[model samples]
Target: MKLLKIAFKSAANRKTGLILASVSIALSIMLLLVVDTIRKQGKSSFVNTISQTDLVVGARSGPLNLLMYSVFRIGNATNNVSWKSYQEIAAFPETDWTVPLSLGDSHKGFRVLGTNQDYFKYYRFAGGKNLAFAKGKQFDDLYDAVLGSEVAKKLSYKLGDKITLAHGLTSTKFAEHGDKPFRVSGILERTGTPVDQTVHVSLQAIEAIHVDWLSGSPSPIKISAEKAREMKLNPKTITAFMLGLKNRTATFRMQRKINQYRAEPLLAILPGSTLAILWNTLGNFEKILVAIAFLVLLSGLLGMLTTLLSTLNERRREMAILRTVGAHAWHIIALFLLEAFMVVLGGCILGLIASYVVQLVAQPLLVQLYGIHIDIMFPDAEQWAIIGGALLLGLFFSLLPGLIAYRRSLQDGLVLKV
Candidate 1:
């Protein structure tokens, strides 16, 4: 009881220094928690986005490239599969369903995806939920379009708003597809995937818009809208297609068949396996971020040490007075340890609160711009382990100054010395 009182009084005397140390520790803890939470949620968002998909088929490319192009909308496809290939694969007995994807166009920097109605039916996200409409209904006509949640919200598009597509994925005005305009028919509910940033349209609509254009660049001679409508504009090529196998056992068989197709070079990949490979390739970046967090934590501990050592000299007379009152050297050590423990504990609490506050503020922006859902909740088991480890580290560093005080008390025994 006496020791506790002594420790409290000693800490009160150095409240300013203690507050500074606590603030430093609190900031470090905030950074560590925020980074860890982002790392965890980032991984969860990626893996959860495509948990139900069986296989992704595309032109001969790396598994990462297929995952990135299809899932992330990050890059362009190296080659496209013909519409015949999609029909053949969809007709296979082992195939349960197929969603054809046509790329190579954008509307105001957002990727425009040309897919059939099966896309909405077969597409699953974040726990296998089918796509739902937040407003209006799906497109019924060739010129009608559906917007992703992000696209609609960012552009403030309504059900009847007409939008023109830019020629390329970039914001430049060089190749605008201005002749054909699309009316927004629906807005999809938020799904926290590339779908949220996409503009969905029918495959026939894609063909209709680019009928006069050859390859990616616009043709020298412009084809009028009326002329394009008269001509047949069926799409012959598609960026890729997603496959759902009827029989899970035949996945390998179908993959082998697709890879060895006689008509064209193609590749079939299990979405899970490709996603794992992609994460492995990019996982090192998260490790680097964690390492940096640890270093920042260490710097915070060092600052605590500096603050204790600086105050040690000023407390010498007070220590002598306590020694005269028969307080042992070990009690003096305990006082310093208790003070540090209190500061670190307080800092950790503050840090956790700060982390939640930050997540709350950033959630909307993250979902809108990056398609990441930041879950603001209590720390998981791994985070608790990190917190435990940090507490021990704080105690260990705090003992350094305590040990110095103990040795000084022993050498200046029973004497009021500087």
Candidate 2:
């Protein structure tokens, strides 16, 4: 306790340099925590975007491509699975539930999902959590729509408010279904996933609006919303579908069956496996981020070391004074070590505070702009391990200055000026 006090007092005498060193450490730690937390949570949230659904089935494509278009809504599907093929697979005795998805529409930049009541009933996310309504009920009419939490919040939509959807995934006024505007029937609760950015409408609405749209161009004849609802609106094909099987053991068998169906070429992928492929594909990027974080930390430690080494020359007299008071060389060493400990400990604490502050300040903006949800986290074992490692590194780096101070005898401190 005495040694720590002496060290702290010594640090106080050089408040500006020590404080600057600590701030560098703090910023480095903050950067590290920010990157690591985002990386871990981003991957976790990505992997768990939808859960309990055994397979994502789509037209034949690479697993990553299928996963991207089907789940993440990233790219256009290579081809769509015929609705007949979807029904055939959905009828499998091993199939527990299925939700067909028709993509390629958008409302104000958010993807439009053409699905049935099965989506609201059977779709799951974040480990089987059911999709719940935040404001209203599911789509009940051909022209009814359901907004994701983000869409409703961003667009300020309410139940019964009419909204129009565009033909393509990008927003352009020329391609909007102006004549077939749909009423907002419900708004879904946030899922912290891609679902939050989707606009939900009945599969028939997709067929109805596009009836006059041939090859992405509007036909000369215009069908009003009322007139279109009267026509048969069964979809000929869909972008993809998600499936849950009756038993986990049937997954591979059913996947193979889907892939080998005679009528059409298809692809079936385990959501978890495909997501793993996606994550692994970006493994190099992750490594680069981690390397950047450590390099920042190393530079901070180096800065602190530089400060301590510079101070040693001027503190020679102070070391001699301690020696005159009967303090041993080890005590002299312990003082600098304690200074390192205090600086690093303070920096880590401040860094954690800064991390939470960043999460609080930037989480909503990130979700809004990019659909990235960064969970605010309390330090777990991994974080504590990082803190411990930083402390060890700080102490180890401090040893050089400690040894330099130790080597200076009483004679050196009392030596006459040149």
TM of each candidate vs. truth: 0.89, 0.90
**Top candidate (lDDT):** 2
Kindly list the per-residue Cα lDDT of model 1 for residues 266-316, writing each as its tens digit.
988998887777777768987887788788778877877888889887777
The true-versus-predicted C-alpha distance at residue 12 of model 1, in Å, is 7.1
Each model's C-alpha lDDT?
0.83, 0.88
The candidate scoring highest on TM-score is 2
Worst ten in a row by lDDT for model 2 = 409-418
Clashing pairs in 2: none
Candidate 2 segments exceeding 4 Å error: 1-16, 365-372
Candidate 2 residue-wise lDDT, 32-111, digit = tens:
78777878888877876888889999999899889887887778899999999999999999999999999999999889
